[model samples]
Every structure is written in structure tokens, then in C-alpha cells.
Target: MSWGFWRNWSIGTRMACIAMLPVVLLFASFMGYSWYSHRIQVDEELAERGRVLARALAETSEYNVISGNLSDLRLTIRGLVQSDASIYRVDIVDSSGHGLASVVSETALAPQRLQYGAPIRKQVIWINLFSDNGTPHITAPSDIRPPTVTTTNVGEVRVTMSPTYLLGKQARRFRVELAIAALALAASGVLAFLLARSLAVPLQEAIHALRAIRGGNYKVKLPVSTGGEVGDLQASIGDMAIALNLSKQDLENKVAERTRDLLASRNEALRADADKRKLIQKVNSIVEDERKSIAIEIHDELNASLIAARLESQSIAALAGKLNAATPAPEIEEIRLKAQAITKLTLDLYASGRRLVRRLRPEVLEMLGLHGAVEEMLRHYDSGSGCSFTFHSEGDFSRLGHDLAISAYRIVQEALSNVMKHAHAAHAQVSLVLQDDVLRIAVADDGAGFDPVLSSEGIGIIGMRERVYALAGTMAVHSTPGAGTEVGIVLPLEDRVNVS
Candidate 1:
């Protein structure tokens, strides 16, 4: 597995594996090197002792034997064995196959019986001291060297030192070293356990904390001072928790703010609608009252005046019927002038009254249609104001529904009225088009325009805005000071004529 992939493991397994791996590898290498060095030291000591015994026997015992006292051999060899407790045995043999003198009490010879000139095993470290036995067995210090040749002063002697005894001591020392190694290995296992526990415990706590947090316990906290990468992780999680809490709070606050704004806007719309309803009712009542009053005034007062002036003119013309055209008398001329003046004045007064009533509310808009009424009104405005006027239309005006026509008419009337009142305008243009179920109307004036922003105090402009709002249309008044104003309305052509 990749090293970094260990995190996917459970906390217990991960910590145990990671913490114990290096510790085990280190302890194994240490034990191996130590065992190797220890064995070398022990083996060197054994070889040194064996060599010393071989040299000592060659130098001391044989020289004495060269002086011709064979009995002295036993005494010197016996003294060498008494020097150390580690030596198990020492012995000497003759070339003629005689039993040798032994230093160890009740030590068995276990005779070596090798033929003359026979080769010895190398790893066995057998020295050739000849008791002249034909068989071979484990040799010792006395047997480590080549046998001496017979000479005149000394009879041929065979020395056999028991290396089996030295080997036994070596084995005992090796057993002690092995015991130390086992102890060391066991100690390493214990230390590794402690180290693994130190790492695993904190990690386990961290895992528990994570689980708790997952289960919705945000307050769960890991133990501090768990130094290293795990500690850093715990700290980062704590920071994330704090951030989550803050983000949640922020979201909640935003939702609350949006809700409050929505509620306030709804309340404002409700209030505007209530006020619009009341104003519409009041306007309807006023228009009904005005229509009644004007109908009565024209029928009674102005109609009587026109009938009287026409009669008076007709009476004078009849009375002067006999007068000649070429020699028309001064009385007839004066009477004709008086009668004509009265007739002209009566006609002008009648026309003026009609204009006043029509300005208030057009009867033509109710009769021939909104389109006819608008054209007539614009023609009147143009004739009176001495300003250029233009009207263009698209789509069938007859196909337009009542609500659409009325709204278009009201918007146009308001715009034109503004142009007449404040624009001091030289030119005005109005366009109405129906496209894609949307009614687009634009009224433009080349007037000495007022600032649109500063014009809100105007009831005339506010009335236009309110009317457009009531029609579910968007109105934009684009104007700059001393420049022209263009009022545009985009209304849905749904024809909701039930708006009354």
C-alpha cells in the first residue's frame, strides 16, 4: 500500500501499523548486528586460549622432556590446568598408542584412532597430538599442534588437549548471549507497544470526535496537545465547524431580510391598489356629474341662444326682401351686419362650449372609437398650438380590444397635455403599435424639456405614471433640461376590459 493511503485504514489499524513498523525494523537490525559482534568476540577469545595452551606446552614441557626427566611432564601439565576453572581437561599421549595422563578427574579419553599420515578435518580444528590411536574424536589444546618426532634425549611424546571442553565453555557463553538477545527482543516489543499506544490513543480520540460531529454533535472537541499531523487535522476541523456555523447564520439572516422586504413591498402594493380603487370611484362620480351638468347647460342655455340668433337673422333678411341688391339701403345694410355678427358670435360660442366639454371627456372616444378621437384631438391641438403634429399607426386599430384602446388613449392624452402645458414645444409626434401581443406607445415632443427626476412633484406626470401602473404597463420618461421629452409605454395587450 502507498504510505499516504494508510489514512483510509481505521484509526486503530493505521496507528498500530505506522508506529510499530520502523520500531520493529530498527530493533531487528540492532539485534542482528549485536549477535554477530558478540559471537565474533566470544569465538576470538576461545581461539586465543587454544593457541596459548598449544604454545605453552611446546615451550615448557618438551624442553623439560629434552633434559631427560619424563616424570616432570605430568607435574607441569597439571599446573597449567589448575590456573583456570574454565578448562575442562588436559592430557598427553605417546606415539605407541599408550593411554595418556589426564588433568580432569574421571574424564573419558574417547580415543582418537587415526591412521598415520591421514588428513584431518579443517572446521573441526583438530590438532595432531599422537596417542597413536587409529580412531579420531574431539581434540583439545594438547592435540592442536603437529606431533613431535623422536630424538635421542627425549622419548617421542604425544600431547592431546581436549578442545571438546573448550567448546563446552564456548557453548555456555553463547547460551548466555542468546539469552541476552531474547531479552533484548522482548524489551523492544514492549517499547514498541508503548510507542504505538502513545500514537494510537490520541488518534482514536480524534476519530471519536469526528464521528460525534458527523452525528450532529458540533460541540464535540478532540484532545489538545496531540502534537503532529493529527493535531493539525483536529485544529482544521475545528476551524471548519466555526465556518459552517457562521455561513449558516449568514444564510438565515439573508433569508430573513428578503422575507421582510417582500412583505413590505406586498403591503405597499396593497395600499396603492386600495388608493387607486377609491380614486377611480371618485373620478367616475365626478365625470357622471359633469356630463349631466354640461348636457343640461347646452340643451337649455346655449341651444336657446343659437335658435334666437338664427331667428333674428332670418327675420331681418325677410324684412329687407324687397330691397334692391344694387341700391341696398343703409338701414338694411346695418341690420344685415348686426344680424350677421350675432349669428357668427352665437356659432363661435357654441363651438367653444363643445370644445370645453370634449376636452373634459371626448364623446368621440365613446362613439366612433379611441383611434378617431385621438386623431381629432391631435388635429385640434396642432391647429390651436401652431406646433407640428404627426401620428403613425401599425396593426389594425379596429382589432384592438376596449381596455387596450382606453389605456393607449389615456397615455397619449396625458403626454399631449404635458406637451401643451410645459413643453413650449414646436413639434410633437405620437406612435402606437401592436406587436407580439404587446402594445407599444411612444409620445415625443421637441419642447423645452424639464428634468424627469425633478418633475415628480407634478400631479400631471404622477397621474400619467399611476395610470400606466394601473394598466400593468411600464412607462419611461426620457428627458433632459432644455431637450425633448419622450414618454414610452409598453403594455401587455391582454384586453382586460372588465377593469371598470
Candidate 2:
């Protein structure tokens, strides 16, 4: 079996195998040795017994064979065969190798048998001491031998034995040995089970405790019931849980403190941002008020002065014309020319004052509302710049508050300014939609667009963004290197006036 397979086995099962395998091997070895030894011993005993019986039979049958008493020898062999169940057969034969008598046992059932044979012999003696008395002593040494002894074969006996009885006895003994070995193996298994259970219980408890710790329950109670690795492990786990609990508590406290600090910092940042926006809006309002005052001053005082000068110049020019017509003088003509130049200069100055008033504060905005103002602005840009401009508006802008309208106009003005300055665009589109209490403004251009990220710091964009932010609106600029730039703005018209 693979080590991985064994490793996956439960501790109890592994321990049981560890405890029982060697015992099983030992028992098997013992049984094999016993069987081999017993078989060898049984075979040897059977051969020796058969040989002894054959030899005794052959010796006794010599007399019977010489006397020609075959009938008695057959009776004796038959009786011997009947007396021993191990003796399968017995035979007696004469010295000429002819069987004189044979008895086969009908009761012996063993398939294996052993055969032994012995020869019957007759004794002979010779005494020759007077012969060769005249022979030389050296040559005829010991002419009178102690006595010649010889034996002649008279008959033979054969015995065949079966080992069934011996095998049956050996089988009985082996059964007893096997039974004892089995009992031993069973006892060992029981002991191993108990031992494994003892270890597994603690291990399972450790696993449970570790699982609890992993699940963030560090308050588990583990009793140290034993001394050794298991007890040490339990104690260590308990300590670790306590330490972790403390660490978690400390970390939570620190997190709570950090969270409070972060919240305060965030509130401070928001307040600062709100204050900055308020300042910007206040500055813009003040600047607009100053511009309006300057425009009114220029329109009321400067335009009147220019108009009076133009009228005086016109009267002088008319007088010079009459004098020249009556007298036909070159001096009067020169005087008429100077008067005409003066009148033209005064008229140009008056026109310049009017244009300045419009630039300082657009009187068209108050007269025509936001839509008309935006359309007027687009027309101005389209006429001045080489770029084409398109203007589109939806919904009535009359409901818009004064501040929101001004801010919207300024935002659009700044956007168009940026487009004209940097976009190098062929065409630009401006859309203003007042819908659902929200004003959505989009300014798109097919121009040499710039990276919004790099150009975000431009004064024009920053001013536009600040104005939108002051009015609580959101503005986004989407552009790529080659693609056109589009500025999308969403201003909530409902509460926008309150935002400033």
C-alpha cells in the first residue's frame, strides 16, 4: 500500500495496523515452522517403525520359510496388519525372491505410504586349524583362524505404512497453537484500539479548539488533562487565544480612535472647502457690482461728453461749409476738414464707450434673459473667431434667479473663451437646457483637444470650475489628444441661488 493511502487512515486504524501486523506475521511464521517440523518428524517415525517391523518379520519368517510353513507366515502377517492401522501392507518372501505370504490391511485409508524391507539370513561357522601346518610361519600366518562366521539369506519381509494417524494427531496440535495465536492477536488489537482512542480523543479536541480559534472565537476553554505533548499543546493554545483576544481588543480600540480622528479631520476639510467657496462667491459678487458701477459711470458721463463734442464739431463743420460756399476760400475748406475729423473722432470715441459698457456688464442679459444672452454671446464669438459656433437652448430661462443666470452666463463665457484661445477648433457647439429644476450646459468642440489632466490647471478652466462649484454645480471636461473636448455641466436651478 502507498504511504499516502496509509497517511490518510485515521490514527486509530493506523495504530491498530501497526500493532497487529507484526503479530500476524509472527503467528504465520510459527505455524509454518510447526507444520514443517511435524511433517518431517512424522515421516521419519513412520519409516523407522516400518523398517523395524519388516526386519523382525523377516527374521521370524526365516524358520517358517525353511520349514515350508507358508500358511502360518500368512496368518502372522495378517494379524500384524490388523493390529496396526498404520501398517498398510506386509509381505514375506523366500531367498529366491518369490513372495511366500502377503497381507494387506483393508482399514488403512491414507493415500501416502512408506515401504521398508529386511532380508532374513541363516548363520554358518567353519573351523580349520590343522591345515597348512607345514607352511612357513611368515607366509601362512594365522592358518588356524579364530572361527569363520558367515550368514546366508533365507527370506525377505516388506512392510508399508500410512501416516494418516500421525497426521491427524499433528493437525489437532496445530489447531491448538493457531487458536492461541488468534487469541493473542485479538488481545493485541483490543489494546491497540484502546491506546489509539486515548490519543485520538485528545487530537480531536485539539482540532476542535484550533477550528474555534480560526473562526475568531478565542474564548474557548480547553482543559489540560494529561502531561506530555498533548497537554503542552492545549496549554499553548489557551495562552495563544488569550493573547489574540487582547490583541484584537487593542486593535479595535486603536481603530475606533483612528476613525474618530479621521471623521474630525474630514469635517474640518469640508468646512474649509465650504469657506473657500463662500469667499470666492463673495469676491465674484463684489467684482460684478464694481463692474456694473463702472459701466453705468462710463455710459452716463463719458457718452454725454462725447455726444456734446460731436454736436459742436458738427455745427463747426456746417458753418465752415457755408463760409466755403460763399467765399470759396481754402482756409475755410481746411477748417471744414478739421471739423469733420473732430466729429468722426468723437463718434468713434462714443461707440468705443458703448462697447466698453457692454463688455463690463452685458445689458443684454437683463433685457433678453439667459437664452438670448447666450445666443448673443455665441454670435459675437462666431463673428470674431475663425471657428464656427452653434447655439441651442431648451426650456424658459426666465424663472432662473439673477445670481444663477449671471453665473451660468459667466461659465459659458469662460468656456467659449477657452475654446477660442486653445481649441483651435473648426466648429463649436453650445447647448443650454433648463429642465426639471436643473440647468444642464454642454460646450463641445471639434478642435485640437488637449489632455484635460494636464490642462486642468489653466486659469480659464479653474475659474469656470470655481464658478460652477460656487453655484453647487458639477462640471466635467472630457478630452483626448486627438479627440475634441466636451465640457458638461449640471447646475441644480432650484436651490442654486441659495448656494451663493
Candidate 3:
């Protein structure tokens, strides 16, 4: 059998087999030896019995043979054969080696037989009456004589005995022995089964306990009922279960503690992020207020001064023009040229001031809402830059709050500026979509884009991202070298704007 096949047997079965096989084999060997010895002994006894019977028959038949009464000898031999079943046949032979009488048992068939022979002998006695001196003395000489005996072979008797009866007896003895051996084997088997069961029960319990431990259930109970290896194994498994359970409890406690700490840390991070965004929003509001104040100062003060200066220069130039018209003099020409230069300088300065005011705060944002302001900015970029620009808007942007409108306009303005300055493109598209409380802005350009990772963050892009984050929005820039750049921004209008 394969190892797998044997291994599949239960421990009790294996142990029982281990305990019983040797005894069974031993008993078998003993029975075989006993049978062989008994058979040999029976054969030897049969042969010996045959020899003794043949010798007795030969001695008794000598007189009969001399008297030539073979009928009586045959009758004696037949009676011997009939009396003992073991003697299958008997025969008598004369000195000439002729069979004179024979008897065969009626029951003798194809029986295994042993043959024995004995010789009948005749004896003659002789006496030496004279000594070697050839003198006999009645009372004077010390001469002595000895008697001699001579024996002659007369006839032989043969006995043939069958071993069937002895063998049958041996078989009966062997049967008794076999029955005893069988009883012993059965008793041993029962004892072995009991012993195996005692061992197997504890082992099975240990296996169950181990299975429970493997399944992560460390709570198990096993009793040390017996001693030796099984008991020791049970004790060890119980100890291991206790240790594992303790470890599991400790690990669970540590995990719970760590989870609490992680939750607190995550909450702290969220709070810090929210505070940062609020701070950024407040700073942006302050900066916007300052820009408005500066725009008002320059528009009200600086522009007035430049206009007054330009009028005075124009008056001086007119006076110089009249003098040149009357006297064609070099001093009159120099005065007129200087007055014209002063007026031109003042106009240029006033125009620069106006442009600066517009950059600081666009009056168009308040007048036309977010949509019109973006459209106007796009128009300004399209007219000034060599790159073409397209504007697309959806939904009502006029419902946007003042702060949100200004932030959106600035974000668009910054995006367009970056497109014109960095993106060497032939076409650019700007899209504004407001729907479902969300305002999405997309600015895409077919330009020689740069890698976002390799390029440093510019002030304009940073400012745009900060504004988006401050308003609790998300911004993403998609760009690759040799490809186009697309900036997408999503702002939740409901969160940032007051519709009324």
C-alpha cells in the first residue's frame, strides 16, 4: 500500500495493527513448528513399533517353521494384524528367502506404511571334554572345559505398519493446540484494541484542540486523563492555547490603542487644513481691499494731477505758437517744442495711471457680472496676443456672489495670461459652465506644453490654486511636453456664493 493509503487510517487502527500482527505471526510460527515435530515423532514411533512387532513374530515363528505348520503361523500373524490397526501387513520367509505366510489387514488401502524386518535364528551347543594336553584327571589335574553356542539364520519376518492412525492422533492434538492458540490470539486482539482505544482517545482530543487553535479559537479544554506521551501532549497543547489566547488579547488591545491614536491624528490634520484655507481666504480678502483702495487713490489723485499739468503745458504751447507766428525766431521755436514735449509726457503718464487702475480692479466685473467680465478679458487677450482665443459660457453666472465673481474673473485672467506668455500656440479655448451648484472652468491651449513635474510653480499658477483652495474648490492642470495644456477648475457655487 502507498504511504498515503496507510496514513489515512486512524491512529487507533494503526496502533491495533501494530500490537496484534506480531502476536499473530508468532502463534502461526509456533503452530507450524509443533505440527512438524509431532508429525516426525509419530513417524518414528510407528517405525519403532513395526520393528518390535516383526522381531517378536520372527522369534515365535521359528518352531512353527521347523515343524512346517505354516497355517498356524498365518493364523497368528492375521490375529496380530487384526488386533492393531497400525499393523497393516505381516510376512514370514524361510532361510531360502521364500514367503511362507502372509497376512494383510482388511482396512489397509492406500495408507502410507513403514516396513521392518527381523531374522529367525537356530542355536547349537558344543562342549570341550578334553584339555589341550589331551588328559583328564578326576581328582588330581586342574584341567577345565567351556561350552560354546552356534547360531544360524533360519527365516525372516517383515512388518509393514501404516502411519494413518498415529497421524490422525497427531492431527487431533494439533487441533486442540490450534484452538488454544486461536483463543489466545482473540484475547490478545481484544486487549490490543482496548490499549489502542485508550491511546487514540487522547490523541483525537489533542488533534481537535490543535484544529481549534489553528482556526484562531484559542479557548479549548483538554483533560490529562492518562500518563506518558499522550498526557504530556495534552498538557503541552493546553499550555500553548493559553499562551496564544493571551497574545491575541494583548494584540487586540494594542490595535485598539493604535486605532484611537490614528483617528485623533486624522481629525487634527483635517482641522489644520481647514484653518489654513480660512486664513488664506482672509488674507486674499485683505489684499483685494488694499488693491481697491490703491486703485481709488491713483484714479482720484494721480489722474487729476496729470490732467492739470497737461492743460498748463497746452496753454504755454499756444503762447509760444503766437510768438513764432509774429517773429520767426529760434527762442520762440525752442519754447514751442518744449511745451509740446511736456504735454505729450503728461498724456502718457495719465494713460498709464488709468491702465493701472483697470488692472487693480475691473469696473466691468461689477457692471456685467462674472460672464461679461470673462468675455471682456478674453476679448482684450485676443486683440493684443497673436494667439487666437475662444470663449464658451453656460448657465446663469450673474447669480454668483461678488467675492466669487471677482475670484473667478481673476482665475480666468491669470490662465489667459499664462497661455499667451508661455504657451506658443495658435489656438486657445476658454470654457465656463455653471450647473447644479457647481461652476466648472476649463482653459485649453494647443501649444508646446511643458512637463508639470520638471517646471517650477509660477506665481500666477500658485495664486490661482490658493484662490481655488480658499474657496473650497479643486483645480487640476493637465499638460505634457509637445502636447497641449488644459486647466480644469471646479468650484461649488452653493458653498461660495449667496445667490440673492
Candidate 4:
């Protein structure tokens, strides 16, 4: 595995592994070095002991060799081998490197044996005085002329000792060393565990505290101490939490303040709208009453007088007709023609008065319903303006209440007036529909339409829009230069409360 894989392990596990690995390797190296040193020491010690034993054997066999006693030399060599358990063999050789006597131990020879040799030298004794009396003397022998000295190599002593005993002692020492190594490994394991816990516990606590903060539990507080980097990190996180909380509270306060201000503005706007509607309704009601009064006065008084004048002219014409005959005088014929002219003028005056009365207030609006009143107005426009109008109505308007009915009627009246006066449309269409508790009205014309934005300068559209808004309704005017005009309105039927 790579370092990434090791990183996935818990801090405790990684730390323990890191700490124990080196200690284990050190102990292994120490054990290897100890074994090598023991082997060398054991071999050297065994070889030294073999050399000492070989020298002793060579000295004892020297006299036997000088006397030429081979039996005694063999007996001595066998006795040495039997004395030492680690000795595998013993040998005595003459000066020519020929073995004169040898002995082998009963024990099996070891693969690794210690062998050593020592040389034997011949010795001579010389007498310098004759033994005449114990008191006297000092006399030189005639044979000692040049101090006769003789030295000769008599034989060699070779000893072979098995290294198994030394090896056995080394094994025992190694067992003790192995025990110490095992104890050291165990101590290292315990120390690693302790070190890992000390490091990992603080980090784990910090991690848990951070997790709590992420979960939105900012109330958590970590203990701070002289723990180095981990401790400092925890303190920084705590400070950040405090900052976040403050920011959150400040933002919430700002939002609440903004919401309250918006609500107050909305309430003010609603009140102003309600006041406007009330004023428009009052004005409209006054205008309607004045028009009704004017129409009643003209229909009752002016039309009656015009009718009386026409009757008087007709009576005069009848009288003039009876007196007039076959050419008579020029004055009488002129009088008759004048009387006829008076009768025609009176009839024209009566017709003009009636037309004016109808213009001021249509009595048919009260007699019939809204639908019939609208139809009558369309007919009047058709006759007067030479324009064709298509009208469609649906749903019952009897229960629509007077305020709404009058409002809808006035809107249509203004729209048509605009069409006749400005539009010069050859054809217009008005539609009234009631569906799903809503009343929809549309007045459209195919004419030389003006831009609605510019046309708002005129009184017609403004009046229609005012009426619609007073009724708590919405209107949209669609018109462009040379494209046609269409005015659409939608009014909620449920909003038709009685107008005060």
C-alpha cells in the first residue's frame, strides 16, 4: 500500500506501527551481531585450550622419546585423551613428522574441531666436579673443553578437541540474549501504545468538536491547554464559530426589518387605493344624477312647448288653406307659403329636443336591463356615425348589482365614444362574458389605431380606465399606429358590493 493507504488507518494504529518498527529492527540486528561474536569467542577459546593441552603432552613424552620407550609414550597419550571429554584425539610424532603414538577418544569427532601442536626438544645433563668429599670442591672436567652443547627435535604432540562443548555453552548464552530481546520487544510495544494514545486522544477530541460544529451545534466548547498545534487549532475553530453566529443573527435582523417595512408600504398603498375608488364613485354618482335631472327637465318642459307650437302652426295652415284659392292676390299666396314654412320649422324643433333628451340620459337604461341598454346605445351609434357594431353578451346581469352594472355600462360607453370620435373605424365589436365568477369585457375596433401611450392624453381612455379601477377591475389597452385598438377588462363578480 502507498502512503495514502496508510493515511486511511487510524492515527493510533499508524503511530504504533511507526514507533514499533525501528525497535524491532534494532533488536534483530543486535541478536545477529551477538550470535556472530559468540561463535568467534567460542572457537578462539577452544583452540587456546587445545594448544595448552598439546604442550603438556609434548613435554611429558619428550623423555620417553629420547629413551626410545614407545610403549610409555602411547600409554601417556591414551591417558591424556581419557582425561578430557572435549578431546577427540591425541598424537605424538618423531622429528621426521612421523607419528610414533596416537590415541582417539570414544566420543564422536565434531565437524568443527580445534587442533593444535607443540614441538618436543631433547635435554642433556653435565657434571663439572668429582664426588670425593662433600666439603671440598671445585674441579673442572676435561670433557667440558668447549661446553659441549647438544639440542635436537625429538617429536611433536598434536591434540584435536571437539568444539561441541563450546558451542553448547554459547547456545545457553544465546538463550539468555533471546529472552532479553523478547523482553525488549514487549517493552517497545507498550511504549508505542502509550505514545499513540497520548497523541491520538487530543486529535480525536478536536475532530469530534469540529463535527459538532458542522452539525450546527455551536454550543460545544473544547478544552484548551498547552497541547501544541492541536490545541491552537481548536481555539481558532471556536473563534470562527462565534463569528458565524454573530453574522447569522445580524442577517436575520436585517431581513426582519426589511419585511416589516415592505408590509407597511403595502398597507399604505391599499388604503390610498381604497380612498381613490371612493372619490371616483362619488363623482360618477353625482354626474349620473345631474344628467338624469337635465334629461327629465328637457323631456318634460322643452318638448311640450315645441309640440304646442307645432300644433298652433298646423291650425294656422288649415285656415290658410281654406281661404286660399285660384291665384287671387300675390300677398295672400305669400301669406299661405309663410304659414307652411312655420309648420315645418316647429316640427324640426320638436325632433331636435327629443334627440337632445335621449342624449343626456337614456330612460331605456332604467326600463330595460344592462344588456338591452348597451344594445340601444350601439344602435344609436350605428345610426349617427354610420358605423357597424357587433355586440355579444352572455350570463345574467340582473343580479350583478347597480354599481357594477353602471360601471361596466360607462366603460363601454366611453370606449365606443373614442372609437367614433377618433378611430373612424368602419366596424367595431363589443363582447361581454361572465364565466367562473368573473366578468370579461372587450371592445375592439379595426381602425387607424393610435399609440395607447400617446392616446392617454385624451379623456376617453382615461375615463374608461378610471371606471374599471373604481370597480376593482383590471383593463389593458392594445393599440399601435395603423394597427387597430382592443380594450379588454376583467372584473371579479364577487367584488360587486353596493356603492354608497
Q: Give the Cα lDDT of each candidate.
A: 0.66, 0.86, 0.89, 0.81
Candidate 2 per-residue lDDT over residues 1-500, each given as its tens digit: 66577867877788778888888898889889998988998899889889889888977887788888889988988888888888888878777888788888898876354579999888678855444676443425645446688999987888888888777888899899889888988898789888778777877888898899899998888888677888898899889889988998999999999999999999998898798889888989998999999999999999999999999999999999999999999999999999999999999999999999988899899999889999999999989589999888899788888888888999999999999888899999999998989999999999988886676558998898888887778999889887889999999976654332
Off by over 4 Å in 1: 1-54, 57-275, 278-300, 303-348, 381-390, 399-407, 419-429, 434-440, 444-458, 471-500
TM-score of 1: 0.48
Name the top TM-score candidate. Answer: 2
N/CA/C clash count, model 2: 0
| Top lDDT hit | 3
397 Cα displacement, candidate 2 (Å): 3.5
Task: Name the lDDT value of residue 365 in candidate 4.
Answer: 64
Residue-level lDDT for 230 in candidate 2: 80
- Distance from true location, Cα of 368 in model 3, Å: 5.8
Order of the predicted models by lDDT, top scorer first: 3, 2, 4, 1
Scanning candidate 3 in windows of ten residues, the lowest lDDT window is: 137-146
Flag clash pairs in model 3: none
Question: Candidate 4 — which residues are off by over 4 angstroms?
Answer: 1-230, 250-258, 302-359, 380-389, 417-429, 435-438, 444-465, 474-488, 492-500
Question: Local error of candidate 2 at 289, Å?
Answer: 3.6
lDDT of 4 by residue, 49-103 (tens): 7889888887787889888899988887777677766777888889998878888
Q: How well is each residue in 107-222 modelled by candidate 3, as lDDT tens digits?
A: 65545545799999887788765555887634435543446989898899988888777788899999999999999999999999999999999999899999999999998887
The TM-score, computed over Cα atoms with residue i paired to residue i, of candidate 2 is 0.80
Q: Give the alpha carbon lDDT tens digit for every residue of 1-500 in model 1.
A: 68788667765566556656776677668667765666566456545664566556645555454444546777776666666533445554444434345466235233222111211111223445445676655577665655445332222323333344445556676677667766876776677667677677877777777777678666666556477887787787777666766776788799999999999999998898868855763574465567758866875787677778777876776566546365678887777677777777777877876776676556777686767878987988888687889998776566666545665776788789889988898999999787777778899988898776676647877787776766667888889888898888887766543334
